[model samples]
Target chain A: MRSAADAAEPAPPVRSRPGGRTARIRTQVLDAVTAELAEHGYDGLSMDAVAARAGVHRATVYRRWQEVGGLLADLFDAAGNQRWDPRDTGSLHGDLAALNHEIQDSFTEQPSLAMALIAASFRSEEAARALRRLWDERYTQSEIIVERAIQRGELPSDVDARALLIAATAPLYHHLVLLRTPPDPHLPELAATTATLAAGAGAFTR
Target chain B: MRSAADAAEPAPPVRSRPGGRTARIRTQVLDAVTAELAEHGYDGLSMDAVAARAGVHRATVYRRWQEVGGLLADLFDAAGNQRWDPRDTGSLHGDLAALNHEIQDSFTEQPSLAMALIAASFRSEEAARALRRLWDERYTQSEIIVERAIQRGELPSDVDARALLIAATAPLYHHLVLLRTPPDPHLPELAATTATLAAGAGAFTR
Candidate 1:
């Protein structure tokens, strides 16, 4: 059976520590998995390929990750753990527009991690749940933007944060990802401005 | 080589002409493709499986479709030919809400054609391009809702129909598909209202 240490993230440690070795190996394996996923997508991803790419023993990957689920779970967990923060642009429109730009960039870039993970979710139930949880966390993190707007008297205090946030960003994804349209440089701000104006007019009140 | 009759869609045929045979075969093959995609997805889809499912000869399937790309292209073409039109609810709010409900239902239904095709697009370039064209066609058809809103003096005459329509429906997809959120009964009306209000205020004016 895998030990608790194996199931949990290793603590920060010096190179000589056992935890450091575990951390190092985990980083290498996850990085390899990311590279494989980006280059060939979830269909081409395999434990053997990941092991070879990481220069780790195949048996180790099999024993630890067990199969694709564990690998994907960890991959999504790593993403959620990243130091992501909403840009504080001193106004709701600026913050939302900046957030939209970040999302736009993520999907438009070649071999995009955002696109890879979203596509993987379609094929794997485990991956789909993981992505759902990740979005939950992201939206939770971004709720502060709405709170800031309310505090600044820019939006009604009772505006539905989730509804407004979805409005401000959904256009970019709708056009680029679903419609596969060329990125319009004006879309990010247009959507944000629309949402902000609507919020100010009490359209998104809960 | 396949005959020119086999290369194009048969005109409304009475089932006795050569084109009738071609049209019949095409319908069987495309129906099988949709069934295979809904049940097994793109990864499990194969020309052999499609042939067996359709009760057609394997060699005929190979001769006609050549590969998955041909199958997807034809499937999308069949979808584009359907006689679909936006609801005429006599007001911007009613029309937008009705359109949102259609989108919401399409994705919520079990073995959803909408969800299946969207997921398939992520895995195949041909499927992706076909989906884009299908969206382009769908958006064009739905544009009349905005035009109607303008003629009724509910929105500015110059409102960008594409942008307004995208805003009206995007929240449903963003929440359901990307965020994997549970179906919100009120989201359809809420999103439509937000977009309609914003459009009336000239946020979507070109």
Candidate 2:
């Protein structure tokens, strides 16, 4: 019988020609890192294991990334830059609900990877830098939703966009990470509504 | 010179007779565990290290707690039951600000232990259970503040107390754990005010 770990092995990396050979290698290596993280978590992750899983030479992994933190930083950069895109749904509530849904889905679908990244951010400076960069990028992009809402007169002009955005997603994160609760189906709607109401009331001003 | 790790070594457990020998041993063992966690985190925590630090025999440590999770559960039980008491400041704003202050202090004062416990909760069933239990206890007690506010006509009776409480503290935890940012001195006040505003506006209503 296949072990649960083996069954959960990440699918082999897709060979892409977008950036040529170097990009393909990078993609392969990162996919392997993701798989390793899912299976063994940050503590059990090792360069040798990632290389072996990626079918790349250990020296190649070492020469490029230098260490686990560097590799993870690159992974965060790639994931954040490539995956997260701002939504302009014409209304702040719709846009926030969409964003909340995405955040909830990420946590629910890739719990191990999410938890590992969160833990690594706390434990490693490199990971922390990478995670911060990712959040900064995402937050910057998403702020437009609030900006549009302000222009549309849906929210106060002085509303703190970042604070509103963070408040919308904080409860879900607090429940998932700190409370260890299962995903609540109502969370996205609740977060969006609460954020909207708070913004309207000037709770996020300044 | 002693390294930073060695200098940060947890102080020896205090001898106490308030709860008798078994209770004293439990206290000593838990204190040692907290120290070990602070120094090395959950990944590096070992029963042998805990026993050594607690000045208890390995057999004793093994015989009682059985594993790290068991030890952590007991610690959570003790800490949750003894430490987190709800404040009755006659107003939701005052109570929430006090609660946020405590959460912020926990993260600021003992980051290592807090991060370790959080990471452990993500990685282990035992830790998750303990974490959930701790949250449940705290949320249940703190909900009374919202309940009282409703009676006092300060908030809508339909407001979701747990959601309000979680939202108030989520951003602080997000900044601390995910962004790895330095603590903002104003976080407690901001959290309390945001929560109070949102609750008053019925954003947290079910």
Candidate 3:
């Protein structure tokens, strides 16, 4: 649970949102949860600890989240909302490269959190469902990248957009999770290039 | 920890080895560890449980392994020795297909064990090293597939054999671990074909 994140420099403060009291409290709780997860991992997380860390009443946390799984689901929902916008970069390759870079940055900035969440998903069905929903949201949002590419004749009309996106990101996850190593610096570029080549060759086509 | 492996059929008995008493004890202990891991995962595993299951003395288990990490390392070593042999199938595509099929079959046959090991690796440094060593041995064994292709001029001499192997297997892991879904039956074929196309295009070459 406690690993490199314990030794690495602290992350920057969570940004203040222009919101009312309830919204502000929610943000504080979520921020505390993130820090707890990064330091102790999902298995070590506790509502009492989160409440103490957030300086909120334990009753408030109990009333709001009810359990760890509910809190995790809310966290994932917030993450989905805050996900990097994959803008149109003029071509499929450029768009995929941008997405891969964003993924790589997320992993680099929060390796322990990323690994903890993955481990949690395997241990808990609730966490797995939350993760699946999070990925589904991201996948749906990013499909526009391939859709636009198809319209521009950059990819085959029959290409499976979701499959293509998975192809681009799968190797990075493989390296981080299975190989238990930091991905190569060039991994994003290689993933983009490989997915682009495979797509162009109709390997991703239904 | 205790999940599908609890309900699924019991694994077949370990075969008797033609060796001394020490070897027989080692085999029994290893077999007990596998069954324990498959049922309770690494986190829930206890030396007492393994010793009781193996019908060996607790003192013997402690004297041999000393800790869960040592037991895991020994389990991984036994797994490496029993790993599926990836034969040369003449063509790179055929060889890759065979390898993917084996990976897919392993996952399908023992989903709980696969997931438990993955989760264990994240939680313990010793498990991570053991898993890495297991993969390294498998990757080294499978390198002959790409090497033969290079010799036949079917792949570029500069193609990275390990990277290609990783690419072919990455998506399946992504589907199983990240997506939390059963992989498509055609995934092995798709993975092999996509990797073949990408490697042919030099996407895996340095």
How big is the positional error of residue A135 in model 3, measured in Å on the Cα after superposition?
Answer: 1.1
Compared with the true structure, what per-residue lDDT tens digits does model 1 show for residues A141-197? 889999998899888788889888889988887776677789898888999999987
TM-score (all chains, Cα) for each model: 0.90, 0.87, 0.88
Candidate 3: regions farther than 4 A off: A1-21, B1-19, B87-90
lDDT of 3 by residue, B5-110 (tens): 2222232222344678777778778778778887788767899999999899999999999988888777766665553457688898888887777666656775
Clashing pairs in 1: none
TM-score (chain A only) of candidate 2: 0.85
Q: Every model's DockQ, to 2 decimals?
A: 0.73, 0.63, 0.72
Between 1 and 2, whose lDDT is larger? 1
Superpose all Cα atoms of candidate 2 onto the true structure and report the RMSD in Å to 1 decimal. 5.9
Candidate 3 chain B has its poorest 10 consecutive residues by lDDT at B1-10
CAPRI quality of model 3: medium
Note the B-chain TM-score for every model. Answer: 0.89, 0.84, 0.86
Better of 1 and 3 by lDDT: 1
The TM-score of candidate 3 is: 0.88
Candidate 2 segments whose C-alpha is farther than 4 A from its true place: A1-19, A110-112, B1-19, B110-112
In model 2, the clashing pairs are none
